[model samples]
Structure formats: C-alpha cells, structure tokens
Target: MGTITQFHLAFPVRDLDEARHFYGEVIGCPQGRSDTSYQDFDFFGHHLVAHISGEGRPLQSGRFDGEAVPIPHFGMNLDRASWEALATRLKAAMVAFHEEPHLRLKGKPGQHVTMFLFDPSGNALEFKSFDDPEQTFIP
Candidate 1:
C-alpha cells in the first residue's frame, strides 16, 4: 500500500497574534515554532506557517466555486468521520466562512462534501471528503 506523507504550507496573515489565537486556540492546531514575524502550526498531520504580510492589513481573497474563496489556501485531505468532526468544530467556533460545508456536485461522478474556511490572515483553506474514497482520482 502507498502512504500519504505529511506536508507543509504557509500563508500570509495580517496579524501573527490573531493567527495564533485562531489556529492555536480556536482551531486547536498545536504550535510548532515562531518568531516576531511568523508562527508555525501543526495542522492535522501537516505544518502550517502564518507569516506577517508586511504592514497590518487584512489578507485578500478571491472568488471560486461560487464563493469568495481565498486564492492562496491549503488544507488536509480528511476521511469521512474526521471531515464531519471538523465541520462541527468550525461551526462551534462561529468561524465566518466563505462557503459552508456541503455536498458539491450532487449526482456527479466526483460528488464530494467540502467546506471552505479562512485563517486569521484571510487565506482560504478547504477540507473535503468523498463518499467513495477510491473515487478521488477517478478520471
């Protein structure tokens, strides 16, 4: 069997402290390393670093998939149960979302349930799950 390796991703945040509170306190990702300009978080089984984008300014986002999705975003590929749990967690946090968690492309071959969120930096991230996991790579 093949193994999916953990990965690392970084994005811009307006305030490092806010990112710390969101990712560390709210989202509950463990802290990795940090400095005055940036902080690293253990996101699921991956690493996410939030860095200051120069001056204190809100991060910009883009529209995609019928929503104002953040352009520079990243997230993990989670299983069905974990994906549902994360959606519950996000709702409990009262996190303002760009797109709510829902089944996308109903009746389609790659039908999936996906949710979009933003970090403290306004960077978009998505966590998705498929009813048939093996269909993830179906062409």
Candidate 2:
C-alpha cells in the first residue's frame, strides 16, 4: 500500500553463465538458490529471476521524454531524496540509461523525475521519484 515493499520479476537470457556474471558479479546482486534453467538474484531487496530464453535476441525499446525508453519493463518508486541520490550514483558508476534522470510528465500533472536501466537479461528497471508523494495516486 506504499512504496513497493518487494517484487518478483523474471526475464529471458541467452546464457545462464553470462546472466550469472552480470547480475551476481558485475551489478553485485546477491545470489540465490537456482538451477540450470534459471537463476535467482537478490536485487537490491527484491527477487529477480533470469531464465535461459535463447541466443541472439534483443529487446525492443521506445522513446520517452526525449530519451530512448524501454517497453515491457518494471521498476520501483523511491522517495525524492533517494531517487536523486540514486541517479547521481548511477551516473558516477557510468551506468547507461535508456532514459536519463528527468521529470517525465513535463507540462502536465504528476510530473515525476525518473530513470531507466537495462539488466544483462534485457529487462528494464525504472527508478522513479516524486516531488509530492501524495500526488502519486492522483487521477
């Protein structure tokens, strides 16, 4: 009923080993019990799974607020200060963004700042923050 407490997401990846390296090694997500067909990751604080889909596949993305944004993606909401700090941290870490940190609904209601990133498994994760947290559920 608040900022999402936790979530579970599964994405397709061509190689389990590569996915393991990326999620578990590069991004520094904690590893979880898994099998050959799939692997689980303790993402920040959520449960994320990567399954062996196939090879040579690319996820289609679109544009949002002057930046290329990923479709069919999922992410979490953070408090304004946390979101700002995360955007700063991602930039400092040289993390590539499908959409740079900026308010999405420019010239409209619920104009919240957000950013998007891709995992090695080709899943999109958006981190969003709102100036007025109460506006979060406004119509």
Q: What is candidate 1's local distance difference test score? A: 0.68
Which sections of candidate 2 miss by over 4 Å?
A: 1-68
* C-alpha positional error of residue 37 in candidate 1 after TM-score superposition, expressed in Å: 34
Q: Show the colliding residue pairs in model 2.
A: none
lDDT of 2 by residue, 1-139 (tens): 2344345455667788999899989999877646656676878877566666655565344333355445446776677777777888899999988778878867655467888788888778888765665444333
Error in Å for residue 45 of model 1: 15
Q: 1-139, model 1: which lDDT tens digit per residue?
A: 1233334355778888899899989999887546665676777767566767657565454332344445356776577778888898889999987779888757866467888877897667877776765544343
Candidate 1 error regions (>4 Å): 1-68
For model 1, what is the error of residue 20's alpha carbon versus the real structure, in angstroms, after optimal superposition?
Answer: 37
**Span of ten consecutive residues with least summed lDDT in model 1:** 1-10
